[model samples]
Target chain A: MEKIKELDLPSDHISEFGDLVKQMHDVDVNMCYQCRKCTSGCPVAEYMDYSPTQIIHAVRLGLKDMVLSSNTYWLCLACGTCTTRCPQETGLLEVMDALATIAESKGIRSNAPEIAKFYETGLSNMRFFGKLYDLGIAGMYKLKTGKLTQDMGMGIKMMRKGKLELLPTFQNQGEMRRIFKKVQEVEKKARGATDK
Target chain B: MKYAYYNSCSLRSTGREYDKSLRAIFKKLDIELVEPKNWICCGSTLAHNVSRLLSLVLPLQNLAEIQKEGLDAVVVPCTACYSRFKTAQYEIAENPEMAAQVEEVIESRFEKKVKVIHPLEVLSSEPVISRLPELVEKDLSGLKVVSYYGCLLLRPPKIMEFDICEYPQTMDKILSAVGIPTLDWSHKTECCGGSLSITRPEIVRKLSRDLLEDAKAVGAEAISVPCTFCHLNLDVRQEEIEREHNVSYRLPILYFTELMALAMGVSEKDLLLKMHFVDTDSVLQKVVAR
Candidate 1:
């Protein structure tokens, strides 16, 4: 996904953001009463730039800049802790995901760029190779994060055990690239409908 | 009865130990697991974080293959993969349009019928473990184990549709079937900093330290887990966690299936206990004597 160009502000930004999420898969943000049940149960809330509850609150108010730029977007483990406890079953993981796409396409940098780098590297690896490569993803990620040599020892150990394949293992890369292309086309068609 | 195995990327590679032990234990119990001809990654956190459609379509395509093979269920051992599978089913089932969109991307019909079962759900099934008593050759009678469910097994309760989101007991029961006395610990369903073990090790170090410390306090000689990421963080990185935190924790993390494989007299060669970074020799000495 490329950076979405800055557009003229919509009359109701919160509704626009909420509508975008709801349109994606009918996410019912209306049921979220800001009870903070999601926040209290989140494992990484303490480390997050915005609490899960706060992120939702930001969403309710349409504070996309704050929500998108926060570290909480990147730190979520998608462990389903909050989603399990949610009385309305809002699926906060999906919310974080929706916010992340908006953040990424709009060229909003994550508060946790290294975390963002890991995801970017991982997704790129999957798109290019048809599957996640443990060694390859780590190499690209270290280069992106400039944290090379951080886990060199452990990498060597895994390599010795033949866990890290030097080359891509899955043979479905051609099909995978096709699928990736088709999805991008679909997303483009979806976005093309928007006035942005 | 037989089911298709979605032995994910990690399971096929880095988590090969888990793959061996899971297949070994299931074989011992007379259950068969068939693999779909060409399954792919679950897209994990990466796909979902990138594109919603990519996340749903990846798992849907895998399920489509399993369904075409006539398997109604696919046993997924990796917790991360399981989470994506369950989430895909949950979201797609709730929205027919989204499911159709995902089907378009993969160019296949996804009926969304595959049940994503984890190892605990399978091995802890009454019919399966009921046969364990007669099958135990080595009898891991006196070993103290703490079953670590980690985060994904039981969270997001509605979507997962099994076990208590917090304080799950399935892992405990699976360990019991293998003859180890499983402890009830407060940290059973806690986060092990999961995939962030790569993005941020210090976070994993702190979280894993707490889990190891709790297991130690409860007199657990080993920590048994079903997730590859959990095993990687808890076992392979324990030494670093211990050193960084100024503590000594000599805990050996075992894939739950490895423990079961041990009790069923599967050889150390099959379990590959030596592959673990933490010394598993001490823990296995007990199982060997049994």
Candidate 2:
């Protein structure tokens, strides 16, 4: 376990962020007691702007800006290590998801734009192909991030090995579109209810 | 003995070897695996990270297909896809509100509870386990590897509910039954920075290097994995890691299914060993067919 940097506190705290997290994930953000168990178990804790424990603390304190803008949630691999090890069973992984979802919805960009772009590019691949297109996602991601040559060698090697598919392989694009549309409608309804 | 097979997007592409080896071994063991029609992607971490409803519904779309196929269980070889199916099952069963929402979105009645299982679970259990020793046409006693479960298969224990989350031994037990031995090592269930491999290669490099270093420290010849991303991160990125760290750890990351296939007498061509970036010759050379 590495030492976590001090959490920079903000004076004005908003309660809606805490409520949003609790309502979205059904997790009690207040259950975290600074145990640091989540932090110790986290593989990317050292790379985080605010460690898992501090993120939960910020959520509980309603430090919406700090928690949402921090790179902690974006860097999370969704490995479920913290969720499994938490004594309080605070559902830290879900909390991280909720935070990222909220951040994306609010159009608040985090420090890690590549991570966000990865998710966006992957979702677009799913939308068009009804599944992940390996070559497409890699090419699109590189174009979006403008790091076109990052894995150029590796991509060619994989293609040579027949590991990279040249064409989209999955079916049922209509079903995927309907699923996305219905999900949007249902989420909008849920948000409307919550906003009330 | 029969199960529906859900080969994820990765399996059709980067993880073709895992798909080939798993199907080959299951057929040899006399266990039936069927592929349901109109199966779509499970939306993965992207769906879950953005919309909870989308995550649950995406997997349910596939489960609904399984239900229509009249199969009681589906064997998902990819641990990430397995986790999504399991999470959908847990969430739907536990919460009526979410279930109703999912049903509404999918526009179908998902009354039957289809069991979502991983290949590791099936292979580790009887009658597969019982028939394993008799089916061994190759001697794998010379090969020693560490069973890497990665993170998704076992963690967040309540949803997965398959094996010991922290120190899982299912893969180890299956290997032992096939005449191969697995060395006890830490970081069995540690994450390999899954999707971050695309966005944050440095993290994948560091974490995967840590896993390789640990496997080397424990005196294991290779590492056996049940997850596609772990295979991609560790095996495909081995050269990059070696170059970046300026160290040599040419560990061949094999799918546990590939090991089972090899031990069960499946040929190298059938298993598609050429797809791997890391040369698996060292591991394959040790297996002598009876």
Candidate 3:
């Protein structure tokens, strides 16, 4: 109850966000019913600024700005817990994914910058190397965040333990490059219709 | 049983012990796992989190490659890769438009027909567990473990659909067959902070502290997990967690396959159990007591 107040939902009506989510995935955003089961079952709900149910409600009411700017979806573990436990099978996790996609393209400032940085570094390295390069991604993230010595002790030990490989880890980079390009080409066409 | 093994990128690199132990155990059990030609990453969480289309195409590329080799069932050891493959399976089945787009993007057809089976599903089946006497060289009678099946493997029951989402017991069944007693614990399927282990260590420390504390509360000498991420989070990060939480927890987080390999009399030196950051000396002392 108190948390919902923090949303400061817009006074005027703009329920299009609800309609928009319904357009994105198979889940019906309107049928949320405010059961609160999704929020209760969420693994990272405590860390979230707004609960999953609250986000769903905000989306249902078309509080796009409020929902997009919030950190709830950013913190979601994608553990599939809330979706599994929902009586109506609301699929909040699926909705969260769709919401995150929309949030990024709209230039919304991420409430969780480290997560965005991690994704940026990871995707860049993954595309370049044709697979995940553990050391490369970690090194990039540290530089971006300027947390150079963050987890340094464990990082040093893992390097010795062979947990961190200090090289480009794959071949066939040309094909991976193609796949990355092809995804962007297709994503623009697919989402450009539903979004814009 | 034969399978086109898709070890994913994690198992190929950071999770070598998992791959090594799985191969060693299956070799003794007479199960064959063949790798299809030209396999690639499943795009991991970055795909689904970034573009739903990449998540669909990347896994489908691997699935199509396996199908081309005529293998109908794929053995996915890494749960993150397995979940992406399963999510792709879900998307391709319901959305024809997305399906056509993915097929066109990859320049190949995804028949949408391959079965994505996890190793736990295969190993825990009655047929495999029932035949353990012949394969067992050292029964794990003295070992006590808590089976941890973190998120991706079994949740959102409609998708993962393999084990119980909240309270999974497949690992318990599989481990018990080798004579190790798996105790009941509430955090069996709890989230271990997922990829946030990299993006947000604070979240992982709290979540894993609960997991380690729960496992200890249940009298587990060691913890067993199937996912590489879970093992890394629990095993690699335990000391940090212990120091932060101001507690003493020296739990050996073992991959389920490594335990299976151990029971088959594979030596500790060969399995590299000692390489674990949170010393497995306790588990080693227990399991090696012929």
Whole-model Cα lDDT of every candidate shown, in order: 0.81, 0.88, 0.84
Candidate topping DockQ: 2
Q: Which of candidates 1 and 2 is the stronger one according to DockQ? A: 2
Instruction: Name the 10 consecutive residues with the lowest summed lDDT in model 3 chain B.
Output: B281-290
Candidate 3 residues A130-155, lDDT tens each? 88888888899999998899888988
In model 1, which regions exceed 4 Å deviation?
A1-14, A193-196, B288-290
DockQ of 2: 0.83
Instruction: Output the TM-score of candidate 3.
Output: 0.95
Task: Tell me the spans in candidate 3 whose CA falls farther than 4 Å from its real position.
Answer: A1-14, A191-196, B288-290
Q: After aligning candidate 3 to the native by TM-score, how far in Å is the CA of A144 from where it should be?
A: 1.1
B1-290 in candidate 2: lDDT tens per residue? 79999988989999999999998998898889888888999987788888888889999989998998899899999888999999988888878888988988988887778988898888888777888888888999988899998888988999899788888889999999989999999979889889799889999999999999999999999999998999999999999999999999989999999998899888888888989898999998899966
Backbone clashes in model 1: 2
- Report, to 2 decimal places, the DockQ of model 3: 0.66
Candidate 1 structure quality by residue, lDDT tens digits, B1-290: 79999888888667888999989888877788998986777798688887888888888888888988989988999888898899889988888867777877877776547888987888778788788777888867678899888877777787787787776788787677667789878888888999789987888888888899999999998998888888889887988888787888798899988988888889888776767888987678787544
**lDDT-based ranking, best first?**
2, 3, 1
Clashing pairs in 1: A4-A105, A84-B156
